[model samples]
Target: MKCIVGLGNPGKRYKDTRHNVGFMAIDELIRRNHWELDKSKFNGNYTVEHIGNEKVILLQPQTFMNLSGESIKPLMNYYNIDVEDVLVIYDDLDLPAGKIRLRQKGGHGGHNGIRSTIDHLGTKEFKRIRIGVGRPVKPIPVVDYVLGNFSEEEQADIAISIKNSADACEMWLKKPFLEVMNEYNS
Candidate 1:
């Protein structure tokens, strides 16, 4: 089994914020598969579905960003999924807006969501897909910038990135993750 987790703060208030790009990508995947996150448990909303013979779980932790692991770890344990079979999607401030990067393992890079995940999972070896929202060009605080909505100029790029992220996820169910990374990382 494989688990795909999207990190974000839940509720309508954060729906369109830059920090919620991970949720956006997951929404795109749910749309494509005609799936709904109908089950709620372990502080997350999730769905179990088969994708080309692979049993996959799509999860959106309702525990908010900084406490994302509070939701992920329990669900993973309940499903008997290993660290290697988990893929976490979240926003990244280091890369330019709309850019996406995939990695087999890495540090949290100061992301509290990832930090919590690492702490709860007791490992830093899970896969990740980072959707870049870019750093604030203005003098605003980092938190404010991440919580803010994207500018009009970034809308197109954001849309493309979300689409690409969803596509890559579907591809992962069929092909090797390395191949999907090579194909999308370009």
Candidate 2:
């Protein structure tokens, strides 16, 4: 079994914020597959289903962004999924909006969610899909900027990135992750 985790804060207040792009990508995947996150466990909303012949669990941790690992480690333990079989999706402040980057392993790069995940999972060797929300162009605080909703101009780009993220995930189910990265990252 494979696990795909999207990191974000829960609740309606954060629904469309820049920090929630990971959730947005998961939503797009669920929509494309006609699946619902009908099960709740390990402080996460998740669904188990097949993409092609591979069984996959799609998870959105409800422990908020900073404590995401609190939710992911348990679900993974219960499912007996290896660290190698996991893919985490989250937002990246460095890349431009509408861009997505895939990496097989890396440090959190100052992302609290990824930091917590690496802490609990005990490694930085898992796969990742980072959706770029971009750093604030103005002088706003990082927290406020991440929590803010996208501008109308950015919405179109975000939409496209979300779709591309979902597509890359689906392709990963059928092909090697490195191949997926090569195809999508280019």
Top lDDT prediction, candidate number: 2
Put down candidate 2 lDDT per residue, 55-149, tens digits, no spaces.
99999999999999999999999999999999999999998999999999999999999999999999999999999999898999999999999
Give the per-residue lDDT digits (tens) of candidate 1, residues 120-167: 999999999999999999899999999999999999999999998889
lDDT of each: 0.94, 0.95
Specify the poorest-scoring 10-residue window by lDDT in model 2: 24-33
RMSD of each: 0.6, 0.5
Q: Clashes in model 1: which pairs?
A: none
Off by over 4 Å in 2: none
Clashing residue pairs in candidate 2 (N, C-alpha, C atoms within 3 angstroms): none
Q: What is candidate 2's TM-score against the reference?
A: 0.99
lDDT of 1: 0.94
Q: Which portions of model 1 show Cα errors greater than 4 Å?
A: none
